[model samples]
Target: MQSAEGTTAEHTAAKGRPTPKRREAENRRRGPVAPPPRTQREAIKRMRGNKQSKEERRKAAAERRERMMAGDDRYLMPRDRGPVRAHVRDIVDSRRHLMGLFMPLVLIVFATTLVQNIVVQQYATLATLVLLLTMLFEGFVLGRVVNRRVRAKYPDAKDRPLSIGWYAFTRAMQIRKLRVPRPRVTPRDAAKVG
Candidate 1:
């Protein structure tokens, strides 16, 4: 047995200070502390939150998603950020993207092949080939235009011409209504393409 001032084997070092006083705790003390929850529902509710906090978190997340989709710079993905990329998106969005029809044409050609008629299949294949060639030519022209505009606006910018041009081309391939980050300017307000 140890004396009052003597240390025992189980004794550890002191914390060096007393606990902090909380005004909120003093104000909240109505009686003895509440006992632990008893029912399963009560316990699970305590484990998560009474639904209010969970709902608040979910609402906040939804708001953040909306802002991200709205092209807020702070919430934008790395690829979509910066003034140049925003300009490219706006330019692409405001134009009627004929490439948007590529998917529909592909489906149409696929359906035509189901006819089993040699003449129909031949015409469908020829049309597809012609469309592909036209799309490739148009893509090249769009790239040139995008690069030229970017270079003109940001003469001293170190951005790669091919990358910016390719980015513009991809954005232009998307349907206006389906484009992520949504369109800011309508076709009526579109900048003239050179």
Candidate 2:
């Protein structure tokens, strides 16, 4: 039918070709650009690709752990990596840390508390507290010394992480055998490094 503007309904509905059915047009827009899976097997095959990628990631992580344990350094945590941190580790490892005695002393004190003698338990508890305070003081001193040495060695490097001192102190507190990236220097070798 003709309208006042001299346009017909057919002309309006037919731009280049007949207007597609609304449902068919919508479906076309929503359809996958990639070819649809032809069968359940194809869908499963695509899903299995994710498992393979995950397996690859797991293997990579295991290899990284192995490298870290072997002292490759590249895979070491940020707190443990870098030349200055390594030097700090060496210095702490070289000396006998009073903090290292804290654990054994604590165990002894704990054992004492298990005894029947109340007097002995009191003394043991007191001694344990005192020992802990002393160790804390010593750790502070150790951290300061480590920070000084690191600053001296790397005066120009100002981007050191804030935890460097704490990292050094903690490593110093650990028994030599338990320290990861196992101490490269002995007490005798420490003097030579300095």
Candidate 3:
């Protein structure tokens, strides 16, 4: 009744059957399977499906970027979205801001720091710190002005608590050529915002 390993075989006749091939046993262990495409056309068709998904992703990204650039509220960041923010951007863009010179001034300060003269370096550092602090104060004042204008224009806006002032101040600080959602108004139109 017992075989070589001392295990009982309920059906003695089944023991006479040949063992399954290694490959067959392995395939069975692997569970469900599908054969790969056997022809070039089939392979191409399968690859096309993958390509389509990649294309879809690329298109979606492009559309999102376009929406962001166009100032679409849904696609814009929380800080940059809404009508009040758009108006703020327009106001900041239209006017000449003192903070706009910050980057260039900082670059000039950096250049000055490279000088080997000890006294000149000390004076340059002092001057740079003073200039940066002055610019910061100017930005704060400009932000307050922009905030006042925004509050006056949109008294009933639900998002009035958003940092519209800081947003305007930062936008104003950026060089016009590098600003996103390009400035719609010129310096001549700056006076009309309020």
Candidate 4:
């Protein structure tokens, strides 16, 4: 039968510190394993394969150090965030993409539905051909229109009109429809209150 103080002292001693062997064993389990010579060789080979030229790396590092020391990062002029316009070619490409995805879906549904319908079955071959041609024509027209609309607002290139493809479609679209919601005019604040 030990005194309360003695038991408390014993408990504290037990919990106070880990034995050296126990600590070493824990460390060994959690520690990184040394790689085999083969693995090391492979890793080195990979690093060499991916390695940039020493001179280029040194130059890049020097530039980075210069930037850090200069501490004028914010003072450095921001890049021009100008809009890029869409050209005719882009409209055509986007139209092609749009139609390519949609037209096939329409054709599949038409084919499946018409394959069983008596009236459609009678003209199935001709109907399919007509659908295909229609889709192509629609694609081209839509693409052309899109190109025009996109070019009208964004302009293919800021300096040159013929720079090609809308680089700023999202921004241009946002600009096209600028609307600030205004508060409703009240009778109390109306002109002459009438």
Best by lDDT: 3
lDDT of each: 0.80, 0.81, 0.83, 0.43
Model 3: lDDT equals 0.83
Candidate 4 residues lying further than 4 Å off, grouped into runs, are 1-122, 156-194
Clashes of 4: 3
lDDT of 4 by residue, 1-194 (tens): 47866653334346666657977888788998756547777888766755756667888877765553333343222321222221332233222133334445556756765566776665656656676676567645554455566556565444442223232222222211121111122223323211
Best by TM-score: 1
TM-score attained by model 2: 0.64
Candidate 3, residues 1-194: lDDT per residue as tens digits?
88999999896466776999999999899998867999999999989998999999999999998887777889888778778888888888877877888889888888988999988899889988898888889888877887788889999876644377678778988988778766778878977777
Candidate 2 off by > 4 Å? 1-63, 159-162
Question: Candidate 4: lDDT of 126?
Answer: 62
Structural similarity to truth (TM-score) of each candidate: 0.70, 0.64, 0.69, 0.27
RMSD of 1: 12.5
Give the distance in Å from residue 129's predicted Cα in candidate 1 to where it truly belongs: 1.8
Model 3: per-residue Cα lDDT at residue 83: 83
Task: Record all residue pairs in model 4 with backbone atoms less than 3 Å apart, i.e. clashing.
Answer: 85-155, 85-166, 86-166
| Candidate 1, 1-194: lDDT as tens digits | 57688965566789998865796568567556757999998888886875779899899999887998899999888888988888777777766767877778888998998898999999999989987887778778878877787788778867798888888878877766777788788887674532
| Clashes within 3 Å, all models in order | 0, 0, 0, 3
* Winner of 2 and 3 under lDDT: 3
Q: Write the per-residue lDDT of candidate 2 for residues 1-194, one digit (tens) a residue.
A: 98899987664454667778998899899986768789999989987987899999999999887788666778998768778878888888888887887888899899999999999999999999899899888888887887777788788755454476788778877877888877788877767655
Best to worst by lDDT, what's the order? 3, 2, 1, 4
